[model samples]
Target: MGEVLQKRFPDMVALFTGLGFLTVLAELVLMDHREGIRILAPLAAGLGAGAILLGLGFPRGRVWATGLLLLVGGMGLLGLVEHMQEALEASSPSVVRLVDEEGWEYPAYPGPLREGEKEGSPPPLAPLALSGLGLLGALALHARKP
Candidate 1:
């Protein structure tokens, strides 16, 4: 198994990168974009695509691919930090009013809103997936026998 993986590492990396890119793109589209950070949605998608292309050997160079992968990884780390900060800042305790089916209204205390549940936020851990994939590709490229 180890030998097989070592020999087919590039193909595996390419396949996983393409799948991850598609998944991220679909998720971004589904999550929709806020006016403030709308540009970031497309930017992330573009970067993911570029990484996929590099992983798939489209341009055929390890150094270029490694650089792009590292860049993507860094962006993911930045995003994770931003998301955690936003979540922390918005986590003050609060009471929300709820209306029941019987048309009765009551004050309900709820836990802090999660990452993407808040307005204009992305999932807290979503960026980590990008980071992991990027780092994995970079490391795989570096480790593969030339």
Candidate 2:
């Protein structure tokens, strides 16, 4: 079993990475990229695809795969930071409510939804998934180097 796994590790990595990228792509598509920053999501998918292709035994595959993985990994880290910041911003109180002697309606009260009332912050840990995948793929590719 050990020998078999050793021989097929690269193939396994490529297969799992491809599947992960496809899942991420589906999520990004469903979420709809209306903002400029959201472009990174699709870009990561494209880069991951390229890296997977290179990892599959192309000429100089290891070099290209490693480079792309590093690039995407860095992007993922940056995205993680950006997402955290956005979450912080979303959680921070944007408006100060001044309640006088009269009772002021609480924002969290169970009532009709306000027009365009936005949802909670984006999942802060989402970007870390990409970063992890990038680093994992990079490590696997490097380990396979002759």
Candidate 3:
């Protein structure tokens, strides 16, 4: 039973990491439709998928795992930093004014969505956190092997 579990560990990790990456990609795509945003989602998804494929195809190779972990981890870390910064900025009190095409002026709510105020959504930190955790797990697993 222990041998069986040990043998399946890498496959399970690869599957989960792949799914996590894909989920993050989907979240990024759904959150925004801008071209700039689209670019990152595809890139992240591709890299993540590639990592999974590499893991499955070359289970004995440490290099692929290391490279994939580094890429995904770095991206996730960057996302975490970016989101934290955004969250901090959102928490601050600020007033914003906007003028419409017809020259109508309106006051915009500052920061993330507040209670009973439903116009804008808050920045997504969940994905960043998940990705970061996944990356850390992968790194730890890698370190523990041999």
Candidate 4:
């Protein structure tokens, strides 16, 4: 089943990988020198679709697994965009200035999905991080038979 799934859903894997890479690179390309905003909504959609493909267990919990995986992966993409932006900003060339720009509307999307950062460490991206987990999980269950 896993092998069948892998063959049938190659695009799903590709989509997941692409979303992961693009979201990470968004800050490098679009917004500020902090630097950019790449189109991420489509990527989010892709991940959701990939998740559904992944959680499609053979005869056991196939439907429910597919649905939940889809939901988790889809939501992860949105969260990644929001969380990645915050991370990139903190890791930006002007990290200090950007961080100090008081009352700023984040100038992008929401800031960090989790609370706190290192004294100087770039912000942690738990949300963005989860997307990878989803990807790996999907990949791992590429062709689950049962």
Candidate 5:
């Protein structure tokens, strides 16, 4: 069992890292259709492709997988920090004005707002978690002897 696991560890890490990239790509495509997605989408897709290639036991698979995982993990950490900051700032009863899709303005919280609560989209926790998992898996693979 140990030998089998050691032999397949890199492949497993690469596969999971690819899945993580795909998750981020899907999130960006579905939830965020901003103009910047044109660049981000393709970049994410490329990363996912690279990860899959690495999983196929390429010559530099370890390097590619490690680099991609670290990059995604770093980005997720940055986004998590930003979201935490926003959440902290939002933990107050403040009147928020929002525009509807039909170009109508309305208060976000019509009734009495509670402290440390707001009506807004939640943070991208899924991607953050996935990235962290991928990073850890990559690190584990890196630690193993090639």
Candidate 6:
């Protein structure tokens, strides 16, 4: 079972790599953000690295897997940064737009005005911290030899 899992894991990673790249590509090209996008480069790099790592599954797959996990952690950190920025923006009206009819419009930010602001913590931070820990574990495992 252990050897079978090891053999199948890389194939799963390859499938996930293809799907993730497509999703990110779609977001980059299609989704329109009210505020300008940030952290595109780091996320892109991570995705690219992951795809390469997934592709290199035939030999030294464990090394590539370690690299893939690191990149995943880096991308998660980027997301945490984004959520923190959102938390800041939640307090103030950072942007204003003028419309011919409405005169001025402020896109709603999460806050006391928005429901559930204080109920729960920012979503990304939890997973991001977990990712960091996982990255560390991956590094330790990579360094250890059987």
* Best prediction by lDDT: 2
- Of 5 and 6, the candidate ranking higher by lDDT: 5
What ranking emerges by TM-score with the best candidate at the front? 2, 1, 3, 5, 6, 4
Top TM-score prediction, candidate number: 2
TM-score, structure 1 vs. true: 0.67
Please give, for residues 7-117, the per-residue lDDT of candidate 3 as tens digits. Answer: 777666667777776776676668563364335545755576666666566657556665766676676656667657756765765669899999999988657776855
lDDT tens digits, residue span 1-146, model 1 = 99998788776776677578677767767766435644464466567667666655654676787777778788778778877877777665456899999999998877666775654444678778778877877776676555
Candidate 6 wrongly placed segments (more than 4 Å): 1-9, 32-58, 61-65, 94-146
How many times do residue backbones clash in model 3?
Answer: 0
Better model by lDDT: candidate 3 vs candidate 6: 3
The C-alpha stretches of model 2 lying farther than 4 A from their native spots are 95-117
What are the candidates' C-alpha RMSDs?
Answer: 6.9, 3.1, 7.5, 13.5, 8.8, 9.9
Candidate 4, residue 52: Cα displacement in angstroms equals 12
lDDT of 6: 0.51
State the lDDT of candidate 2 residue by residue for 31-131, as single tens digits. 88446887897789778767876876674778788889888888888888888998998888555455657777444434554796667888888987777
lDDT of 6 by residue, 1-146 (tens): 99876755645544554455455545544533223444453355345545444444434565666666567667666767877876676556545444566566656543364552344334545435425433553454354333
Candidate 1: which stretches are off by over 4 Å? 1-5, 58-60, 93-122
Task: Give one digit per residue, the lDDT tens place, for model 4 in 62-87.
Answer: 45544544455655666666766667
For model 5, state the Cα shift of residue 21 in Å: 2.7
Candidate 1 vs candidate 6: which has greater TM-score? 1
* Per-candidate local distance difference test: 0.70, 0.77, 0.61, 0.49, 0.60, 0.51
**Residue 119 of candidate 3: its Cα lDDT?**
53
Model 1 lDDT at residue 41: 45
Window of ten residues with lowest summed lDDT in model 1: 33-42
Give the C-alpha lDDT of model 2.
0.77
lDDT of 1 at 5: 84
